[model samples]
Target: MSKLVEEFNDYRTRMNEVILSKNNLVMKRLWNLDTNTYEEGALDKKTKEMLGLVASMVLRCDDCIKYHLGKSYELGVTTEQMYEIFAVANIVGGTIVIPHTRRAAEYWEELQTNAQ
Candidate 1:
């Protein structure tokens, strides 16, 4: 895997372990909710992930963007669809989201490279 992708996954995993080890009920429940929310349902996992990517971009959360981007890629979202998602996010989020879009593109590239 690319260093960028590997590092992100490693750090996220380590932190999640630490956080979950605390045994905080609310945090655990919230995490569980997040997990369950992305399951195959009325909307389907792929569509939900696309929406997640859009919302993450608009919110300017790089981590969330990366997470959704990874999921979207795994779910077989095409490059064309990704660009469309970016366009929608840029439109809804305004110019402020441009920087995030750049980062997201970088992360997506890393994901592609890792896959190869």
Candidate 2:
């Protein structure tokens, strides 16, 4: 498998473990609910991915942003959509998102370079 694919799988596995293990109480409380399902009604996959990308970016999780950006693109998210995601990120995550926004952009650019 390609290194990128392998790394993504590793991240997936670890994220799953963290969720299952209740690595953080907030994670368990907020995301691990039984009502949590992929049923986003009419929400398209790209929209959901865009939401995730914004969240990861605002949260300053490079690993998460990298994975979600790849997933978002695979789901047909355009660069324009990414810009929208950034806007929503700032709106939702607020001032603390400034630093994370910079870092996420750096990580995203790094990933693009590595892919070349």
RMSD of each: 0.6, 4.9
lDDT of each: 0.95, 0.69
Error of 1 at 91 (Å): 0.5
Which residues of candidate 1, in runs, are more than 4 Å off? Answer: none
Enumerate residue pairs that collide in model 2. Answer: none
lDDT of each residue in 2-102, candidate 2, tens digit only = 46556777888897787768668776666645224333558866677777788787777877777787776566666666767878898988988777777
**Candidate of highest lDDT:** 1
> Clashing residue pairs, candidate 1?
none
lDDT of 1 by residue, 5-52 (tens): 889889999999999999999999999999999999999999999999
Q: What is the lDDT of candidate 1?
A: 0.95
